[model samples]
Target: MSPGPGADSAPAPKPHDDDHTSGTAPGDGPAGRGTFSSLGIRNYRLFFTGAIVSNTGTWMARITQDWLVLTLTGSAAAVGITTALQFLPMLLFGLYGGVIADRCPKRLLLLFSQGALGLCGLTLAVLTLSGEVRVWHVYLVAFLLGMVTVVDNPTRQSFVSEMVGPEQLRNAVSLNSANFQSARLVGPAVAGVLITAVGSGWAFLLNGLSFLAPIIGLLLMRPAELHRTEPVPRGKGQLKEGLKYVAGRPELIWPIVLVGFVGTFAFNFPIWLTAFADKVFHAGAGTYGLLNTLIAAGSLAGALLAARRGSSRLRMLLGAAALLGVLEIAAALAPSFWLFAALLVAIGMVGLTVNVTANSSVQMATDPAMRGRVMSLYMMVFVGGTPLGAPVVGWLTDHYGVRVGMATGGAVAVIAAVVIGLILLRAGGMRLKLDLRRGHRHVRMVPRERLTAVV
Candidate 1:
């Protein structure tokens, strides 16, 4: 189950690595720690450029949507419902989505998904601009958008191989995380200003426009240069097979399990943040922008830190989870909005670090042929837990208060980390060995206990 370590390959920037048509250079080349080059293919530059533009816009839409709902009805439960509708499809159809991902052309799938998402954005924009937006309309659109995301995420993940080839895959995944986090920094602030100025509706309109970047990249990509996975026709046992493949690997299992809990609990920061600003923080939309920007500032640092460590190790992942847990706890207890925002910066940094580590580690360890299935499982756990867990947090916030709900979530995250650390060390037959003399290269190895799901 433990795919081999990706230590031999340095993650690189896409543009730098793509031009070398010759096969991988044998070991002595200076390895990159954090750029688009990891995949040895340079074209990821185009991919990265497009993604950077798109992701920031997406974040803007998300914050605006949440803020709008809070404005319209003042119902936290409704926000929970909106969030749940968006994510519930992943729990229901994510595995099948994975099966399709392994078989589909990722670029084409992305095109269709992006198109659908853009249309939804446009619809939302029109509704908002007309001053006719309704809670029910938002709910329905959220569900539709979620459906598109279910298709988009898996295809996008599996497509990484095509952009950079197998050699730079680990680095590619890590760098991509950095890109996503980087966009996180800019997007919220922009959305905050726009929301407060023109209104939340304009933010949606802009998101619709941002889709152009990726569409352009896709169109411009040289078809002949791509590394495509062969399509697999649907069969009776495909979904089960993908599940069995995941069930077999402890390296994969523990990371996904940990992320499921942590991502689910910690990611509700958006909901908690709006509450904090309105309730405890007593800030307006502008402060909401600052809060988000501050967190992204921490995340940008985290993504950069992750980029340095050449390999994704179990120890780094666990450490991040544990640190983030502490920060989240502090955030919930903060006496002032400024203090809470400061805590959020640290929370975001550690959160992104853990996320990138887990995401890169799992992607690197999975078989190329089964990569889609594994990545789908990873996404499903990370996002699926949101629908399941967010509602509970929302309910807690609605009744007990945002602080209580967030604190509980942080506590749960800490417990999840502790448990995962134990499982990896004991039952998973992993040993912790740290090499501080060098950068943090410590790792857990489980060759003997590894599970093979190909059968």
Candidate 2:
């Protein structure tokens, strides 16, 4: 993978072609390599430090926003609407956002997007503080934020490779998730206290101020050290070309399809958790925050474990997703609050595993030239499906019990994992095998030819 046309500006080393090997110097042994190895790079360290602060504020805003919407309308369905508005742009213009990401400098795009996101938060903060806020005002700000995220999400994802290069990409991606989940552990707890004491306005104000850290970090980065890719020139048919490229690769395509299914139906936690906290348990905002914090604890553990691994596997993605579904079902049926809370931790761990595995696998399989567009489609299917799924989940929670709504989501995840797993196996010219003998491999996917020869 040599640098394409127009990449001459940056004189950094080219990214390695291999995905599994770390491309380290001979003297750099195991001691120099591990989960935190990518943080050794100065630029990534700055980015990581700034990102943790911004991510914490983002999480606080999320908790505060959901609670505010719930308090205003007193309907679970309204919270779904707010979530939907915030993600609607991704569903509609996600591909175009990818095209823009490929054409523009990712760092610049992130700066502009982050600033716009901060403005949205500040606007909401002002309205709420002045006692002029209405439900529609929140909806409008959410939609504006989504418009910015249409460009921000893919840009931020593709930027990781530029900072860490190929060998350390998987580790960096896993660490990024760990950073978010770590913030998640604190954000909701803080939001709960603020909402109870000062009010949601203060949370929004803090979130608006948080974007400055990332902006300053970006300015401090060294341009010559970045592994820059040539920006895709403006041209016709590029979007279609990106789509066809993904369509041809089973390794890239199948994992994405599986995530799309799971993300769409099973990942409606905003709706389910809020409903359970309010309706089922008769608890207040503190309980909702506690549920989120528990999930975050498990997610942080899952992300740390992922960072320690050397590679991502499709099998791991499938297994984790299946486990996520089973855990969700169990949590949905728990008879007591303590039991349900305990299950949430396990569910969070498996859910994060599924996310990290799929994300790294897809990025590893993609070409640098096509990464922006590929990641855009990846994010589109993953987060974009929220608009369609959230309202339905909210309605179900409103009409049927929260238990039924959550269990249904779990059922969808289980069915999707089984179906996609079988498809991937068959596509690879393999078949599932079962053996019952002691000390034997009981279940696995064997090559079709190997099974035929055994028969």
Candidate 3:
């Protein structure tokens, strides 16, 4: 999931400890409570804690789901199909989800969607526990979960601003990434143990139970403390308006487009990891879990850095994307399992940097009124691409080889970075330059007019 970016409002300074209430006073601007500034806001703290619990379960369920499908069917393609079905709703209905997000109260929407997702988890748990679970059953449950996520993702994303406000928006977003990554670190290890000890069914059940924390947190929040924005009015063509809004901003649209490529192709980590573990490395569930844990460790580090950095920038987002692309290629060519695992850490860091920066930048560039729609679009382009890309990558891994699939994704990501970078330079009216000064070479991207005059 992505975070919203820069703001039209200047970020108010960190709030004083002496002036603090249960949270900030109304209209006082967003307060960075401390380094963990967003936590200073009571509402945000509740949301944060609940989110971490839920994210752990979410990650556990993801690993279990893929592993279960592979165990049941003994086919990587089956896992791919499950993955595609899980994200297909985001591709098909993500825009409508965004439209609904704009029109509804996000907290209320989250409560309903979270419950629906829990029910899906419970159902899958029951079916699997019965030993009657089928590939079709997994497929159906995955599709249903995806349907809920279509609404849940954008609502949850847009809700962060209301909890922490614009002042801590970037910090809150980075912390959210950190929170999710932390869950990723813990979830898989636990799931691996559970699967080895008892079964995947228990992992699903735990996930179902995990949703309760967030629901309770949402209920306990003081609604009045929320930094609320007006919901978009019900009207036709609002979707088109959101589309036009993104289309008008080169900075926003280009990163989004780049993410679409990366998300579709490069971000299929679960598939890649699973293939490497089961096939390439001839490893078991334990090794698979370790690989995920390493990536999450790197992701946590990246998220923390992003939080301390305090702002999202366009240049950094692009640079991260390019670096991530290069890292993926290196990992693809890695000869040993340990080397590949090590590369995953760098992959996780660069990948999370790209995600956090792009998410923050998009949110910052958007109008509060239009945030839900824009974020939905951002999610749509980034996550929705998975439905299209996963199965193809899976097929390539199954038939050609895992390295081939990995290389394909990396190559596509690198191409996307170069193309998007060129587009940004052209839009900014600048050109790349290489010069040698005092025997030390420097490459500078300079204005087209300056280059012409110098010539």
lDDT tens per residue, model 1, 105-185: 677777888888889999999999999999998998988888887778878887876676655666677678888878888
Q: Measured by TM-score, how close is model 1 to the native structure?
A: 0.87
lDDT of each: 0.75, 0.85, 0.84
TM-score top scorer: 2
For model 3, state the Cα shift of residue 139 in Å: 0.7
The clash numbers for all candidates, in the given order, read 16, 0, 7
- TM-scores, each model vs. reference: 0.87, 0.93, 0.92
Preferred candidate (lDDT higher): 1 or 2:
2
Backbone clash pairs in model 1 (N, Cα, C under 3 Å; residues 3+ apart or in different chains), count: 16
Write the candidate numbers in order of decreasing TM-score: 2, 3, 1
What is candidate 1's CA lDDT for residue 318? Answer: 74
List where candidate 2 sits over 4 angstroms from the true fold: 1-33, 452-455
TM-score of 2: 0.93
Ranking 1 against 3 by lDDT, winner? 3
